[model samples]
Target chain A: MKVRVTVMLKDGVLDPQGKAIGHALQTLGFDGVHDVRVGKVIELDLHGAGEEETHKKAEDMARNLLANLVIEDYSIEVVS
Target chain B: MKVRVTVMLKDGVLDPQGKAIGHALQTLGFDGVHDVRVGKVIELDLHGAGEEETHKKAEDMARNLLANLVIEDYSIEVVS
Candidate 1:
């Protein structure tokens, strides 16, 4: 199975990198561009794991290393 | 409308950060964890734009700001 995990900054978090990119876009003449928030996606390929086991593993991966839960939120999707 | 842009390291790209994260996961006792690749997602909220316009804007954003096309691949979705 394949798993996709998306980790994003929580609302109200200050995203300096996103802000910098937004500024760059405006400089490049992209009109009507507003706020830009950047997050992360982690794609995983698992072997010999059922959906239940894979979900648990993916959650553990997110909490342990993939995302900083204090400032980021994560969601996982399993593709069989 | 809102837009989601996902950017990922291309196949065969060396992702040192992802490797480090994978190593950390294994050290933390995550069994069966294999390769891990980290990517990015950018969310945008736009004002006064139709779906077609938003799609065009999103493509421009991906090309000019959100992604490094040389080493990364990106996809965009427009949410109305």
Candidate 2:
């Protein structure tokens, strides 16, 4: 199975990288952008796992490794 | 309008970050994972733009600033 985990900063967190991107976009003349938030997408390919088990494992990985729970949130989806 | 751009390494490119994560996952006993790829997800909130214009602007931004076309590929999606 293939699972994709999206890890993003929590709503209240400050994202300097995103701010920088927004600023750059404005400077480059694409000025309609008002907000930018950058996040991570982790795609994993697993073998010997059923759909249910794969989802569980991916969630476990997100909780333990992919995201910093204090300031980040994650969502997982099975792609294949 | 809201646009999301996902930027990922080209299929044959080396991804050391992903490999290290995979190794750590195995070491931590989540051994079903065989491959991993890490990518970026950028969400932008734009004002004063129609959906079609937002999509075009996002594609332009991805090509010009968000992605390195030589080694990465980017996909844009309009969320709202």
Task: TM-score chain B for all models.
Answer: 0.92, 0.96
Best-performing candidate as measured by TM-score: 2
What DockQ does every candidate get?
0.77, 0.92
Candidate 1 lDDT over residue span B1-80, tens digit each: 88999999999999988888778877998767677788988888877899999989999889987789999999989966
> What are the lDDT scores of the predictions, listed in order?
0.87, 0.95
Write candidate 1's Cα lDDT for A23-80 as tens digits.
Answer: 8888998878778888988888766799998998899888988889999999999977
Ten contiguous residues minimizing lDDT sum, candidate 2 chain B = B25-34
Top of the candidates by DockQ:
2
Per-residue accuracy of model 2 over A14-46 as CA lDDT, tens digit each? 999999999999889988788999999999999
* TM-score, structure 2 vs. true: 0.97
Docking class of 2: high
Best by lDDT: 2
List clashing residue pairs in candidate 1: none
Clashing pairs in 2: none
Instruction: Report the lDDT tens digits of candidate 2 across residue range B20-79.
Output: 999999989988789999999999999999999999999999999999999999999999
Q: Which segments of candidate 1 are over 4 A away from where they belong?
A: none
